[model samples]
Target: MESPDHILVVDDDAEIRTLLRDYLERSGLRVSAAADGRQMRAVLSRTAVDLVVLDVMLPGEDGLALCRDLRARGAAHLPVLMLTARGEETDRILGLEMGADDYLSKPFSPRELLARIKAVLRRTRALPPGREPASAAATLAFGAWRLDTVGRHLLDAAGTVVALTGAEYRLLRVLLEHPQRILSRDHLLHLTQGRDADPFDRSIDLLVSRLRRRLRDDVREPRYIKTVRNEGYVLSTAVAPQVTLRSTAPTDEPA
Candidate 1:
């Protein structure tokens, strides 16, 4: 389990909301409850939260719509986990594509919910200001590129932003944390993959390639990311103090 952090849960089911709020609070997390998207917006406008446990179905504006709006607006860096009725694979996949950090089906165990939360927070190493491992929360910037480890957004020097898929975000995060270091696909797979490490149609290489294209990096004579031949890839550069992404495009193209 992760250390204490604020968690906002949005669900119309009063029973589920109460149970989650009570359980999360007992687990050492500050909890906030919202009945729907509107309520969630209200809460978000006033307070800050580390993660969001969003229910897929809401009374008026549905959770998926809310997720899209949140991602497009400014919460792109904020991690969102969706809840749905069990056996809803379509919703699960759609949620992932929409940039949700994770999801849970109904009839889920509280223990599982807690475990997922811990995993994400651990991988991200999120912490508030004035916390332990001071550098862990530090933001890294390379030219116009900014990686806010805490806020979880990548900002360009021009103040534009590019939204990253959850998996891509996690994979890039691991790479950035170890700049100038060559991490093989296997090692990266192990760090980013789920439990059991099931050997499925999985690998971070394709994602890396896509990421390189977005960074406008030359694969042959790369600037930001360098290929290590049969070994892996290395990012060679020092991150500036802060780089603000435009929040306009996912990543800016070379002008």
Candidate 2:
């Protein structure tokens, strides 16, 4: 039998930690709690955690910093669900920018948090129904970059590997699969994140900006991923699939 998914919960609030631990445990998941980044790291070092539920406010290192650090340490594929006391849009944007898979504001319902956790895990572990697997193409080439669908690495013209966060890779893959077509923010959000975007949600736009940065595409005159005035964004380039040997360069997560 497969082991239950392990969750690492990092928060300074003892009550919150205990609350989540007990709540999640009741839901048939193995959970470990940490007080801060130090304990979080300790747990991560010794445990095979499937997901991390990180709080933005902590004792030493904030959740944003820790999340960024995790990405820098090549844990891109590991799902992270960020929690923040502040309901500000900037906090959510920063969390997403730092490679968080999902964000939730504090004073949230445990049931809701559990739902989000399951949603994020589902997204990271498998493709949604009716969606083709990335493995269908060995490599997808567009412009000067080639994406190793199997290995999930982005290769440059010189075959140098460029790290991409899970979110970035998903957005890029969606664009590449539907090149030369305008994709509204709602559509892109649904395709990449498996959810509809709220009126105030700009996660899709932020993801596009991050992806453009990864591709080194100038925002003003992007050769690929062009923006349509009010509709949305498009790849504006053709994607060619190549069955080639994968890059041997060392792979790391996005910083």
Residue 86's lDDT in candidate 2: 57
**TM-score, every prediction:** 0.63, 0.91
What is the lDDT, from 0 to 100, of the residue 159 in candidate 2?
87
Candidate 2 stretches with Cα past 4 Å from truth are: 127-137, 245-255
Model 1: per-residue Cα lDDT over 1-255, one tens digit each: 764688899999999999998998898889999999889999988987888898898999888889888877756557788897887777776676566766778989888998988777665443332342433446677745876654455667686766565566677677777877888767776676443323432235566775676577778777887778878677777655543333432334311
lDDT of 2 by residue, 29-140 (tens): 9999999999999998897898999999888899999999999998887889999875677889999999998899878999999999998887776632113443343689
CA error at residue 188 for candidate 1, angstroms: 3.9
